[model samples]
Target chain A: MTTDLKAATTMNLTIDVAKCCGSGQCVMAAPDVFDQDDDGVAFLLDQTPPDTERANVDEAIASCPTGAITVVDG
Target chain B: MDAVPVDTDADTRTDTSSGGQATTADDGAAACPHLRKYSLTPPESRPLDEPDYFGELRQECPASTVTLGESGSSWLFTAFEDVKTILADTRFSSSPLTPGFPLEGAPGSDAPVAVTTMIRSDPPVHTRLRRMVAKDFMPKAVEGYRDFVCATIDARIDSLATLPQPIDLIESFALAVPSDVISKILGVPVEDEAMFQELTERMTTLSLTREEQYQVIGEFAAFCDRLISLKESEPADDLLTRLTHEQLLTGELTREQLAGFVIMLVSAGHDTTAGMFGLSVLTLLQHPDQLELLRSGARSWDSAVEELVRIHTVVRMGPRRAATEDIEVGGTLVRKGEGVIASILAANHDESQFGPSRFADFSIPEEKPKHLGFGFGPHQCVGQNLARLELGYGLPRLFERYPDLRLVDDDITRLRFREGRAFFGIRELRVHL
Candidate 1:
């Protein structure tokens, strides 16, 4: 029986671009889930990661210096 | 918030006695009684064991009115959430040219335009200027200087070892580290350190009259202009050279703009870090158990530095901003053109955010919460990563080098804080190694 990884861990990632000062803490913490645009504002690379990636996503949210990243559980 | 017309004349200002009591204006108009009066400069004395005065103010009135001497009154936001909101909100403009901009120790009219650089400019302009050198200050870029920083700290400590007992740590070590580090970064010659140090000290002196302050600032600008010219003629692998060679040549930056940038970097690069270094040492010495834990390797240096910054927030008040539009913050309506001051110290110590233990105790928590020590939002400290690297590496090494370090006076009250300065720090920390 194959388990759906996306269904198993439902998390909504949000990035407030206006608030992102490009400190890059989020990208550093979870490179797979977050990236920065040319202007250095943060953007979400993966809106929903597997449950196994929860730790990294949480770290990124917490590490964000401007509190620009938020994660909502589905 | 209520658009109170502030009288700028010092002589005409109502003298609210040091007891912090509400007094009627000279015209017999009743001043807002609820408006809490607290001096941000040399903040009112409180017991060392007790939380800072701002913490109490935050608990009582997170958004209250405060009079900053002749600088005029403004709304003070103390709650962590509100402070963060104000910092991140674009409506809260950083330009001193904006009407009702909250300024401390600056002339009311015709203030030097040079002073309004990246820190005072809003987006597009601010974003452009900040991004020019932002990469140099990032954590990865700052990590490249780790070896040089260590060597500088060791040299300073080694020199202090030969000095007499009960040396003033601020003079012997704390102040020198950042000064030397900034000098190296700016490509300043070792022989010219004395000149730049004197200029920076004079420029940062809050007690100076407006005229006197401007005079010193003018001299500093001239010095920087000369430095920029020298860099243009003989470029080096430093920040100034990089800016002059890359930005100025490309017409991305002008000469005056480059000088302003240099002034900001040279002054801010050293002053705030020096304040943090001195205060962190004082905080650690005050709590010997915590110091012991750190030395014993029970507590990580990273956590210790974070806790140190959390406990002793060097930048007491965030840069003043004028609300561009009416906004409700912490149940108070800050009207358009109203000035706002984010009480960083109060927010850093908010019990709600950090909990009772970590808020009160100096012990490093297992989980380090996000702190406003480096501030938040676009205008948050640009050199934070560099400052962190310096503190993280410098503090541990200093303690390890002098394991038997102790204060000359155990009484916290005996320590002289830098009164009237924008930054909060111990002026002269006498220590015996």
Candidate 2:
């Protein structure tokens, strides 16, 4: 399922590119909110995923090898 | 540049091309003139100052050929995008049975039936076989073994603490952890670990003669057959038993297929993980600042492990694939029937993808780049979650137990590597706690 872009914008998702080891676990765990750059480093497709996408995004954060992705509550 | 002879001594050099397709060039030069004749396996031979010789090639000749002694030559792809594309694209076949496919050491016949495991298959068959056991290797599934893995590491460390100073980390801990974990997963009795480890070691040794390799593989297959029979009557909670009861008995898999599965799992699960553990430790010790960061909690152990795997890639050359049809990779035309070796080592160190200090820098960057350490696409390592868990649990506990841990030999240059092996790792790491 897709996340609501407007709702996601409120979530304050940030990805530290340098910390991203590019394991792609984030993308795998939460494809709607996370995507990888050409080099395989992760990027936020949607900074603030909707409440519906929270669980998977949480999983993405937990699963990230480098802990590069984070979600701050608005 | 002219073709450089890798080995001057005839007796010592390994001829990797037993079933290699004959080259059209009489003088053993690659068809592509710009392609240099180089052996990608043993990175230790390269000059110490220029550790990243392959990086030079990735820049100058992204797709080049390297002659493999008598076995002819194969195309080597060095760029990150090219390597990933080749691995993901189905146009490149993974089957070594195909004629002209690059044979690194010997003919596939010398290897076990499992040499034809799902890793070497393509499309529907690979998808079917891999799907059967894919769930067991998922992050969640591997996470189930976390407690067990951590406990095992602690127990091993506890045992090592009793040992005298200058302990070989590889023998005492690194090798033992993964060996035990894989054994437990396969339901092999702990007492029989030495036997299985021996077989696995022999099977992975690139220096062994074809006959020797075949013998070891035969023993391994027979061992798996016996294990399968045991699981047949009395099933356990382990993977082998699950495969036997759930997949094999249901006619979804054949006896040989079960054997292949067991063999592949046992070998893949331990060797690469063991190599990573030893290499990571060495890499960290060489860079005390990074080690201090890890120990001080400045850098998360999870990130450190990923960075370690990325920087100290064990698998130099991934499985060779033959181009099914003429395909363009990184602007180079790889003609049909040409063999391609995706240099996982080179791609991981590609500066453009990972920034300038990708190879030399030990510090973990805030932006972690995707690496090919576990490979990519459909044939990506199934046991990656398990391997990562082992590293995540093992590395920190190792350093925490002995914060003063350092190499006994200050000269890192003297360190002995498992030369000519498919996986890169220290033969012995004498560490003082």
Query: Judged by DockQ cut-offs, is candidate 1 incorrect, acceptable, medium or high?
Result: acceptable
lDDT of 1 by residue, B164-189 (tens): 88899998788899999989988987
Candidate 1: regions farther than 4 A off: A1-4, A7-19, A31-50, A62-74, B1-32, B36-38, B41-53, B105-110, B113-115, B355-361
Which 10 residues in a row give candidate 1 chain B its minimum summed lDDT? B1-10
TM-score of each: 0.86, 0.81
lDDT of 1 at B148: 94
TM-score of predicted chain B versus true chain B for each candidate:
0.88, 0.90
TM-score of candidate 2 against the unseen true structure: 0.81
lDDT (tens digit, per residue) of candidate 2 on B46-114: 311124558778778777776654545788778887888887677788877665577654333325484
Writing each residue's lDDT as its tens digit, candidate 2 over A5-66 gives 66645677899775554456776678888875644456788876677788788888766644
How many clashing residue pairs are found in candidate 2?
15
